[model samples]
Target: MFNPSQFHETVQRINTKVPDVQHKASQIDIASVKLANEWFIPEPVARLIIWLKDELIKLVEELMNMMTQVMEGIEAPITMWEDAYKWETVRGIATSVAADVNPSSLGSTGQWTGDAATAYTNAIGPQSTAAAQLATIADSTASSLRSCAEAGLAFYIAVALVVAQFIAAEITAAAGDASVVAAPAGLAAGLAAAATAVGVFVGLVAAIGTLIGTEASQVSTLHGLAVDSTAFPSGRWPVATNI
Candidate 1:
């Protein structure tokens, strides 16, 4: 069985192998801690990973925060939807209800994404279970995607830290392999191999819903709204949901 727990197990396996992973040669001599293709890494790239980890942490933090705001903005259209609904009842449905977005809190940085759009649409589309439950569905869809993005950021940050730590351990154990300049390449190869054996989440996290290819489709109401009212240019379905 392809266990979902493979991700964690592979990370554990990675810590074991990178300083000692399945190498390019293709051997599995784990008894001796040496395999046919197992290899070591170079000093420079290994150090680079450390530096990269530090830098990535800062950048990813900013990304995570920014994305959070964008999802929040996805809900901005709800007010517009409600106001229009009220106007519709009062005016006998004679005027086109308008949608709006306000970025008073997270600055002008928050914007929608393709995933946000798809989520909103899936909830409100005629075929959706949420069409009649727009208020709840809109919030839930934005919240789900926002949460997914946060999870991805956390995953990468953790991966960066783990990668740096494990690779450092590999470097310490490489004292006897100073004669091998091919170690770094081998280390990279080993990481790639482990990543393969692990899963796609090993590299970069895919877009929201991309892991299983389940992004949302457009409905009539969602087709014309702005994807990003603040920064991201995702979808207008959030606005549509309020109505």
Candidate 2:
């Protein structure tokens, strides 16, 4: 009875200091966490990994964007080819040439316009098909390349520098990961270049195809305008017959 109350007061006094102790402990925990962050690599390498990770992610995104552009580019030449197929000026020229040759034979000559239109459509089909196939290939392959880059970026964080053995293994893994990224990076770039070249080639083919269609129509026009050899003994007919 003499010291029970005294002991109780002492316990309460100790309890008052517990908050301070806890605060100190919390600070220590924070420091430990920071230390853990540098567990496997030195500060420079740690920083480099973060930078490389960000850069690799960016590269992957860039390649994806380029693939989208390449696919869209393929459609442009195809659209041009379609528009050229419907172009009416050449058809009109064919009509005029037909009527000029002989109004009586205009119906027969009109078939030339149909023939040229058919030829123009035929020319565009193969080129457009090829461009579309290339676009599809680029889309699929670039997607694969981006996957490699993403996989490499996954290893960018060097975990717990505190364990030397763990760090060694992680570093090795990171090196392999980096190589994975490097390999696909090259493939994506090459594919972009190839897609660009194919796009240009498609455009050239479309233009040339249109020209060929026009030339074929012109030749048909000349044939229409010519008097048939069968109609004249001299193998030529006069421009006009007796009214």
lDDT of each: 0.36, 0.36
Off by over 4 Å in 2: 1-38, 65-74, 88-175, 178-243
lDDT (tens digit, per residue) of candidate 1 on 1-243: 112244345445534433332231112112113322235544455564333333323333433443344334332233333443453353332111211122222232236448665555443332221222333334434443444434433453444454454334334323222324543444444344333323333343344236323423422233332233321124333334444
Q: Write the per-residue lDDT of candidate 2 for residues 98-206, one digit (tens) a residue.
A: 3443324336434545855455444433333333333333343333333332222221111011112222322332333334333223323423433443344345445
Q: What is the lDDT of residue 159 in candidate 1?
A: 45
Candidate 2 TM-score over all chains jointly: 0.26
Clashes of each: 17, 5
**C-alpha displacement of 142 in model 1, angstroms?**
2.4
